[model samples]
Target: MPNLKIEESNSLISKAVIMTGEAPSAEAVPVSTTRTGQMMWKDTFYAGEPDIEAVFDVDTEAIQLYQSQASIKYGSIAAGYSVLYAAFLAMGLYGIASVCLVIAFVFGVLTRLTCKRATAAFNTGGIHMAITSSCVRYDQEKPMVSTAIAVQDITTCTVEQRELKPYCGLFGTNKTINLIHLRVANGSSSKRYVGVKDPRNFARLVMTIKNRPRSAAPPVASSEIVFR
Candidate 1:
């Protein structure tokens, strides 16, 4: 049977298996309405109900929108300089035109390269559920840092504005998840404070997934923790 497994550092918590045959009817949950950004978790398996729910205020996502400064740098003014220099050179304005073209070419290449890096950094393409036992790996005998925060430590959560159709690029502060930065308690840590696009729905969905009955409780087979 396909089961939801959590890999961990400690053998005891290394691989906790959960029967996910009874998960919610939803095939895939829509994470962010702001489809503008790549889907965080595309196709992933998550344990059902009673999973930890952490809501941090710190927005972990590093989103990049078209900045005004960037616009100015690449705007009409810059284009005008290129045009004027090209025109001046055609009119026999010394070697100034050649220098202008070289500078433009160099900067253009640099701009393209910089944009590529920015795109890579902002690319979001995976689900980051709360850190599970598999992720902790107690067997390692060392503190673990996860890309996403653990749900168990989450005390309170709040969702702001569900109507903000983010997927459609509808702007205006529609929906937001405010979570507590877990790593903050430790002082200058590297743990990531990730965001769950739809905080309310995601929480409800997780609970449903984890809490689902495990095949009628296995018929109370033998009434023992282990059956040799």
Candidate 2:
């Protein structure tokens, strides 16, 4: 009789279970923070979600400034007209009062819409934003559409800031808000980052990180412009 030997590898992985293995780790996750802000998340969890293979920056300050500005704008419209409406009514000018009421209502509606957009953009308690070489993404729990935008698809990220003014007119506030207007390809599609105080830094980060594909250079027109 002959004795046979069988040695165990003691590894968690089994030889028979070779087809499936541990997933590969994501690359280039820095241990330190960037100059702009702090990184909140380095990876994504939800399916079909953003592939943020970089740091997720959280703004130190809340974006409530945007909503405040909107409120001021709408409040002015509503308040100015509301006073007129009240005066017209008190003066027994019912028709004029009705017209002022309608105008106020219309302007109030615009304010509501602006607030809604701001909510999606960055009205959350804190802005969770991430920028990779491939795309840009943010945490918008109730976004109008997908929150991720491919780098190539992004045409420009410009700062939409209100200049400092000592006073305001009856229709609007002195300084409305500071936001980032993100214009994507086709120009029609867009996104907004509301109440971002440092809009220039935000825009610069996105523009610098994203690597847009360059078009092939055209041939020189005067290459064959000789007398031949």
Candidate 3:
């Protein structure tokens, strides 16, 4: 005979247990290898059905590319300011030369800080993305950020790839970096999911959900339903 036990949280069912009357003989009990906090398929079902989910690690190449671009833009501005500073100094305009020099130093420092922060962010576990019939959700574990966007609000999904040249002595080869960019109906408002695996497939999944016909049945509240 076995007794059934139920676990509840806030008066809501969370888990159940079955206790046998007789203790299991030595070697009869099964060994379990599952770890706590590790994500399973069921964890992604928190929102519900017709959902496409993916977990990705940070894309180093993409981060590098972004940093490089930022550096180039800021570096160019700084270089221009530096030239102006020198010209002003030669023209005996001490006040303007000092101002230009200060501007150049600020831009140079900003470029370094931008790249450093970007690198730190990626070092944290990448991201988890889920796209459902009604919305798209994404969250990052470290730094703890989350966002949910209604599918209907999404206007565009695009995948872009760029070649990156890394310096490895004299024989280094170039690598390609892929990025998925999304746009909303609101002007100049957009979001990007970077360093994702199979970005094209993810984009297609979003498009399909966005274009999906509305269901006639009333929407079920996520909390009320239990997924087995």
TM-scores of all predicted structures: 0.27, 0.47, 0.53
lDDT of 1 by residue, 126-177 (tens): 2234433212110110122234333333322223322222332345555443
Where does candidate 2 have its weakest 10-residue lDDT segment?
Answer: 219-228
Query: How far does residue 153 in candidate 1 sit from its true spot (Å)?
Result: 34
Model 2 whole-model lDDT (C-alpha atoms): 0.51
Error of 2 at 155 (Å): 2.5
Window of ten residues with lowest summed lDDT in model 3: 219-228
Q: For residues 47-108, could you state the per-residue lDDT of candidate 3 as single tens digits?
A: 33334333223465666555666677787889999999999999999999999999999999
TM-score of 1: 0.27
How many clashing pairs per prediction, in order? 30, 0, 0
Mark the regions of model 3 whose C-alpha exceeds 4 Å error after superposition: 1-52, 56-58, 82-113, 121-129, 138-148, 168-171, 215-228
Stronger candidate by lDDT (1 vs 2): 2
Q: After superposition, how far is residue 16 of candidate 1 from its true place, in Å?
A: 27
Better of 2 and 3 by lDDT: 3
In angstroms, give how far residue 126 of model 3 lies from its true place. 4.3
